[model samples]
Target: MSVPETPSTSRYEISENPEGGITLNIHGNMGAANAGQMIDELTALLSDYSPSSLTVDLEKVDYLDDFGTLVLAHLRKLVTNGGNGFYVINSSDKIKELLSILHFDSLDEKMSIEKKRSSGIFIRIGEATLQHISDLKYAISFIGSIILSLVHICLHPRSLRTDDTIRYMQRVGVDGLPIVALISFLMGLIMAFMSSVQLEQFGANIYVASLVSLAMTRELGPIMTAIIVAGRSGSAFAAEIGTMKISEEVDALFTMGFNPVMFLVVPKLVAAAVMVPILTLFSDLFAIMGGLVVGVFMLDLTAGAYMSQTIKTLELFDVFWGVLKGGVFGVLITWIGCFRGFQVRGGAASVGQATTSAVVSSIFLIIMCDSVFSVILRYWG
Candidate 1:
């Protein structure tokens, strides 16, 4: 090794070692005053030389500050990233301590890659299949429980709570009358107006009476009334019973040797079964009145003529089937509501979820059963 005189300016001496590596010796004060120059010189050296390994000699450096430490750290990073081994030799204790605290010595060279899993079609299909099977089982259990309860009530009539049943009927039926009538009347008006546009083209506007009457009696009347009751009474039943269940009142009833189903559910079921059909009849009448408004005003038909056409077109079986559909829908709404309520666990949030579920489930069942009725009536009639 040859000793060289101290230099006035910051500079570097690059040499090719016989041991198959390159050495860069930095001399003079490496501080903020000459940090930029040092970085520029290092950048030029990297462009000029291609070395398999690099050894940096820092022993000749007189002083090193935070900025100079940053430059050296950046240069070390460059050398290691170029597929070469980087070594720092003859570093003073102060320089080593500063670099150690800056975490430059702990840089990880290995890259981390994330692996993603693909969602396959068969996996999704299998999950859906299992969910549907679970739902079907739940439905079967609910239906069985309802049937057993009803049969028990039939065999033991005196055990039925008539007062509770009447009270529920008043709440679910009489209180719901004005809104149900209003909606049915609007629906009939819309149906009559829309149908009359096409019917009037052929000068057959008189048929609007028959169209609204038959549709209201056989299909719209029961369906609309049931949907209204499901939204109103079903959600109420779920929320009320769910609150009771959550508050432990239902458990108290059970502890007192009372049949919760017979006491709580049967009255609701009976009330719904009794009131819904009556509501359906009222819905049909209101809807016909609305159709009469369109007929007498828009179609310029006589009230007598409209009533006569409606009477002639609407048969006894049409009203019977509509009322039957109403009864079935009522039972479905009440049972599902009470069932969901009984299923409640936890707090008020669970009660709210149960109430929402009851309404949604009742509506779905109503639509499905109505479809089945349509199919059966098509074939049977």
Candidate 2:
């Protein structure tokens, strides 16, 4: 079987060799524009004749770019995989040099992944351990920087950016009030209703106020506000700074001789620390009101009695302790959010990952810190 010769205008010629193989005589200027046509013609001839072996002659291919090289490389793979011998002959130094640069001749075999590999349990554990250690070191370093910035501001009040701090305070605190109040109120109502059912069986329904008051002021109010802020403000911080980092704005700050920590992070930190406590106080008040609603309606307690019981049950220390927890949690949330943001190294997808990490880390740290406070207060109080 034989193939027709190429016309004068054609850049490639196909012919059949009597020795049971086909020869492709490629000519000048193979590039992106004509590479597709070359491949199609070669494919058609290969399919019609079904050559046992194929050889591509490239002596006349004066200029070969990456695209043309890639097309030819694919042809080689197709011939070899179909149980036929494939050979390239008569190439100049320029073509060879370009092929070598791209490693086009061996691209498929190098890139082929026949099967996915899974790591052993121990190997995965080791990798995870190392990653966490690196992350922990980063977190510590970030915390140190924040503390240093705070100290510097304290020593030189004029250096602090008060305007940014106030803006963030309004955003992180005032903007978040509605949701915080709603969640806290619902939490208190549920707690009171659940406890009232049990307390009523014991004919101690009035103690419902005591339970709601103590739980909200000592634990729920601070923790709920912190979690809300983590989801709201912490994630926002990470996303904002991560976007700036990816867009090279953070680098521009460095070029302008601005400390990013002092300029960007300190205001957020101060605002969060200052406002979280105030939000917690609001949360506590709203939660108590929710419990009062339950006590008056569900528990059949008079309004005055519920108020009297709540007041007697809650101590100044309990309220102050919750507010203190709020302040500490505020620091954790803001620091983790900013730290994750600064850790962003790549493009838009990295910013997304950093935002998620910030929210998750802040929530985790808040719960852990609350646990520690619970343990210490158990012993101290």
Candidate 3:
């Protein structure tokens, strides 16, 4: 009959012609669960009659999920990469929505999304890093203020010779001795035992004394003492000054015509700078003695040999430089703590924040300065 011919109900229709090679049209949902079987059938068909071009007519696609989208993408890529062509014609809005979600709208223009992601991730990170650097810079500027304060006092010699000096010395030096001794002794004992285990293997047990003395005098002693006093005395300085600042006592001092810097910052600053090295020296001596105990008892090295070797290896410059580094770190620690405390806003929260920031930032600055000194010593010493 010359009646209208009905379209084939087959999901895929293939045709071959004498003039051209082959064409395939697929219709229906070939999502993840069914995409595998669909691809297998399509590949089998393609192997039999390798087509020069493939056109997928998606006009009748009711919907597509991730699987169906992936199936189409892979076939398109294969044909395009093999010097063939792939075309999608008459896609429905429903299929477009799925493709859009997979970011397949413009396959060739995806560098922009990658650029956006890179910006979004690392740009925020850069801002955070810059903020930290700014905070550190502000802390460094505080050191300049201290130098100016010293120059002012230098012009007026009467300022340095005061009871404040003696009182501050007692607080920072004598009051700090017990804690320094305890920490140093324990540290030396730990280092000696740990080093002994390794050095004993090489039958160089006597070198344990050298290791403990060098480490204490050169590195561990100064760093550890600074950290302890920073936690102990630095926090105290902040809280005490912050309380005075909040309670209007600092205002009273100004009203009485007494310079608050001389009464407060100068005393604490001088105290920390002077006594931090003393504490570190104490730590070095105690730690060395602690290690000596282990050397005599376990390593069978006499106290005379241990002490002689220690003196022979340790230069006066090593001890002096360590103390100087301790002094510098101490000054920074106290200044920041007091400055942070004085700059506090609000109430208890601000106090807590200042105290915590003082400790954490003091530790960070201590570490940074240590690194700088290490680098300098590597080249200079």
- Stretches of candidate 2 off by over 4 Å are 1-134
Error of 1 at 49 (Å): 43
* Order of models, best TM-score first: 2, 1, 3
Compose the digit string of candidate 1's lDDT tens values, residues 202-232: 9999999999999999999999999999999
Question: Cα lDDT of all candidates, in order?
Answer: 0.89, 0.89, 0.80
Instruction: Spell out the clash pairs found in candidate 2.
Output: none
TM-scores for candidates 1 onward, in order: 0.66, 0.74, 0.63
* 83 Cα displacement, candidate 2 (Å): 8.7
Write model 2 residue lDDT over 1-381, tens digit each, in one string.
112233222366788889888898887656766667767876776677777888889987756777678768877877877789888788877777878899875787785666878899999999999999998899898888888988999999988899999999999999999999999999989999999889999999999999999999899999999999999999999999999998999999989998899999999999999999999999999999999999988888999999999999999999999999999999999999999999998899998999999999899999999999999998999
Segments of candidate 3 deviating more than 4 angstroms: 1-141
Q: Against the true structure, whose TM-score is highest?
A: 2
Is candidate 1 or 3 superior in lDDT?
Answer: 1
Rank candidates by lDDT, best first. 1, 2, 3
Q: Write the per-residue lDDT of candidate 3 for residues 237-334, one digit (tens) a residue.
A: 78877888878888899899877766778878888888999999999999998999899888899999999989988999999989999999898888
Per-candidate clash tally: 0, 0, 0
